[model samples]
Every structure is written in structure tokens, then in C-alpha cells.
Target chain A: MLKHLTAAIALLATPLAAQDFSEGSQARSWNLYAEIPAKFEAKVVDLVCEFTGDCPADCGAGKRQMGLLRTADDVLILAMKNSQPAFTGAAVELQPYCNQVITVDGLMLDDPDLGARNVYLVQSIVPPGETDKIKANTWTKVWAKEHPEAKGKGPWFRRDPSIKEIIATEGYLGLGLEIDEAFIAENF
Target chain B: MRHFTLSLLAGLALSSPGLAAEGTRIQVSGEIIDTWCYYSGVMGGPDAVVGSAHHTCALWCSAGGIPVGLLAEDGTVYMVLKVGDDTQTAGGDTLLRMAAHTVEADGMLYERDGLRYIVVSDVVSDLDITNKNHEDYGNVPGFSIPDPNK
Candidate 1:
């Protein structure tokens, strides 16, 4: 009887042990510049829908916002971040997996501006029962074909006329607060 | 016994290095602006403008779940984070209501990667309640003149 009670007690303690392990592992993975490669099998969800339970048809397409409802803890949502300009990185790859359960491989980025929110910069996504298919960043190709004049011209923002106007009037120094000038000058 | 073990684990997690508070309580006075517009310089001009003119747009963007940031008088932009216990109420809720108005907020400030975040506890608007803009008075002919009889 004592042995059985010991076994039962150990079974009850298992979850707590697992939780502690996860917390420690996650804490160690919180470096900003370091890209911690991670794999997660989760449901692709729109943040608005996941939080409000009001799923939209296009899944907030123009916003390019998507998150992963981690299978291990459904309550925890890993918001995906775009690594490229014009929301063309993970946003483009995760577009096909909306509202579907899929496996995603990515680098976890700790974004200070987002407060406690951590971003998953997705590298590739695989549908259930399918082999891993590398993400080729097809959106970049499409963007290049559409804007042939933009080739080697610099980042999209540099080529943007509206941004050019702001730069011309404000100078790059005027983009932030006047106080930020010293910091910007030192950094950039 | 199970409950005790779980509680202990929770305590340890909360007291962990990254989760523990290395900051002190601070009072910051600033204008609440939507972070997207402030950082991206897209919709609004790059310089953080706080006035009645920008209030409507700031409220709209903040209400749409954009992160609200406080551009303090000291020129520090603080990303308002929800207080630990108050998960339901976003930090933007109060900021949205007081958009474009100067407010003094009491909060615990945490810093990481040259960015600052404040988990606000209290907010007090600096704008006078009785002060009315000319637009609020509407078009009135010769209303500027005081009554001579009084």
C-alpha cells in the first residue's frame, strides 16, 4: 500500500516537474540578438480571433498578423513577426496555414518594444502528414517582378515617395524626438 | 501535498531572474500616442505631436489594439505594459481615453534593449476640466465681448 501511494504521488508531481523544466528552458532562450531555432506544432490563428473568439474570413490579411496557438498550452499564443519589409517574411509563409494545425520551424526573437510578447520568425511550415518543405520566400520574387525599377535601389522605404517627402522636410534626424538625436548620431 | 508542491514551483518561477523586478516605482508625465505611428512615422509626422488635433486618430488606433506609448516630457518613449495582476485590462485602455492630453502616470518601469516599459498603476490627466477650446464653443457672433451690465 505504501509503494502504491508513493507511485501515485510521483505521478501527481510529474506535471509540476515538466512545468519547471519548461520555465527554465524558456528563460535561458531570451536573448535579443541570438536566434534560437525552435519547432512547434500549433494551430495558425489570427490574434484578433484568438483573443476575441470572432474569426474573420480573410483572417486579417492586410494586417499580416498571425499567431500560433501552441499545442502544449493552448492558452499561450506565439505571435509571428515579419523579418522582411512590407510584411513579406513569416506573414507570407503562414498565410496558407490560417485556421489549420501545422508544424512550424522558426527562430524566436525577443522584441523589447513588444514588452512581454516574444515573436516567432517563421522559417518553414509543414502541413500535417506532409514532408518538410523549405520556405523559398516566394513573395519577394513576386514583389521584384512587380517593381522591377526597385531592383538594387535599396530598401522599400528608401524608394517610397511619401517617406522621401518626410525625409526631405524632416531630415533623418527629425524622424524621432529632438532628444533622440544624440543617441541616434552615436548609434547610426 | 500536490497543491503545496505546485505553489512552491509557482513561487520559484515568479522569483526567477528575468521575471523578478529590478525596477522601482516611477511617476512619468507625458502624452499618450499610438506606438505604431510614433515609431513607423507613417500616418503622423515623425515628431511626437500631442494636442487636440491628434487626439481622435490616437484614440482610434489605440482602440484597435495597437500598443499605446507614452512620450514623456523627458523625451523617453515608454511602452505601456499591462500590470501583472490586471491581465484583462490593456495598458492602452486608459491611454486611449486620455489621448493627446498630458497625464501623470505612476508605474513600475522596466528597461530592456534601450526600450522602456511601464506597467501603470494609476493615471491622472493634467488637462483642466473647465478649459474649453474655441471649437467646442461653436460659431457664435460677437461672443468674445463680456456683458457690460454685469
Candidate 2:
């Protein structure tokens, strides 16, 4: 599975860039992503509920995995991420649209090797009859509200006090202070 | 240009009538890894980001919505689509619970564009974070954990 992906796609305009194709062992054209561009209409559904009948009233309240049940092919495309510089899932954005049909404009990635046929990264979404496209940035808003203290000039992860606290308490190796100290002594 | 390929996940077929991703069933064992950091070379080299040292960050990354990849024993990252009763792949709660843990799973495999995808039917056994590489490489990137000093 690791062999199937490369960091080459990280050079895209958006932090969401996913793949790169190096042809003939020489430098070739750089693509938008290792994914396909996709746009379509679908009903938003919680994947767990859709697959296991464990339907929640709020689709896990943006905490569960949300998918778009495509109207075109009835395909359940996992709406993987939002259009954020840092990694953010699309759950928050799509949860509100649960069971409601909406138009999606985004990128699609699939891995047949692991059986994930088509995974989606939503760049934008459109509610029924709405001409304007909603950028898949809902997670950012939620993050800001949740971590107003984390607001800063860099990626949210770096400024996130919660993450910083975790790292500080656990140490970078995630080992308690003792093991980390031993590792420090052994290495430096 | 984006290439159109056939998608076949285990236990997960396109609900489309008479149409579905034709996947092959198989049993595989490996560690659930963060494909973004592993491939992106962000947190550290591939070796630094697996097993115990990377476990904490792995949970954070998975929760953050980076696609979860199963770093197989042979060093392959099988992109996990759906596993067992989990409704969604990647950032799903179940995937979060399984973060960095190694497991032997029965599932279907599909290949397209030189990539492998999986839809796990059953997780036979979970080894639970067995890589334990922090002894060799301490907290790779040294950033996954913040510096208490600073």
C-alpha cells in the first residue's frame, strides 16, 4: 500500500495535493493530484449508519465518517477531507447535509489494491438549487470556534494548544519522561 | 489526466444495481499507518513514523482526516477503505481506535494506478502497536511531541 503512493503530489497549489507520476524515470509533467477531479450529486449519509444500521440522529455529530451516496451510480464515495492546508476531514461539512442531496466538486482517489475504489476530497459543495459553491472549509470554522486560543499565523496543528499540551506532556517520542530521557542519553 | 480505474473493496461494493467494484479477497497483516506523513516525508522518514514512537501522532493524523494506510509486513501501505463494521474509512472512529495497531485482517484487495486499496471484512487479530521502534528512533521529528522546555 505504501508503494502505491509517492510524495510527488505534495507539490500542488493546495496542501491537499496527493500524487505524482514520474515517467521514464525522468521528470515529466506535474499533475494537480494523484486523484481524479470529480463533481456530482449525491445524498449525504453516515457510513456506519448506512453500512451497519447504527444510524445516529446527528450523523455522529461530525465525529464519524460521512459519505456521499452518489445519485449517478449510487456509489458511496467517502468524502475524505476538506480544502485545508492542514489535514481536516469533511465530516463537519457533510453531516448537516445528511440524507439530503447535494452537488459535490472535489477530487477522487482510489486504491484497488486495498479495495478503496474511489475516495473523495471535497474542495467545494453545493446545496440543492444553490448556484454558489461552498468551499469545503467547514472544519476550519469549527476548529477556530473550538480553539480560538490556537488562532495564529501558521497551520492549526502547530498552534493548537491541545496538541502542544499533549506533546509537552508525552514528549515527542510519546514515551513518558523516563524513556525519553534514556533515549536522549543514548542518542545525544 | 486522471485515469478511470475499477474500484473493488472488500464487503463494500457500489450499491449501484448490477455494478460494483470487483475486489479480491485475501488475508494480510500490518500496522495501520498515517499515509500522509509516511509518504509526505513530513514527520520523519518512513521508518520513524511507525509502531510505538509514532502512535500518538498517528491517532492525531487519523483523526485529522489523513487517509489511513496499512503498512504491511512487506512494507506496503494498503489504503484502507472500509473495515469490518466501520461505516466510513480513514477518519472514522473505528479507524481512530485502530490507529498504529497491527492486525491480521481478512479483506478484499484491488489494484489500479499502481496503488492498492482494501475493504477489510474481519480483523482476525489485533497486535496493538507492536512496532515499538522508539528505542531505535526516539519520537521522530521531535515535533510529534512538543518540547516542554520551550
Runs in model 1 deviating more than 4 A are A1-34, A62-64, A82-89, A110-118, A136-152, A175-188, B1-150
Best by TM-score: 2
Recovered share of real interface contacts in candidate 2: 0.21
Reference-based lDDT, residue B113, model 1: 32
Candidate 2 chain A lowest-lDDT run of ten: A21-30
Q: Which candidate is the best by lDDT?
A: 2
- The DockQ values of the predictions, listed in order, are 0.03, 0.18
Candidate 1 structure quality by residue, lDDT tens digits, A105-180? 6565433443333345555667867975556255555545545765675544344343344334433322223423
Q: Residue A36, candidate 1: how far off, in angstroms? A: 2.5
TM-score versus the correct structure, for each prediction: 0.45, 0.60
lDDT of 1 by residue, B2-68 (tens): 9999999998645543224366789998767655444433333434223433343444444333446
Worst 10 residues of 2 chain B by lDDT: B10-19
Q: lDDT value for candidate 2?
A: 0.67
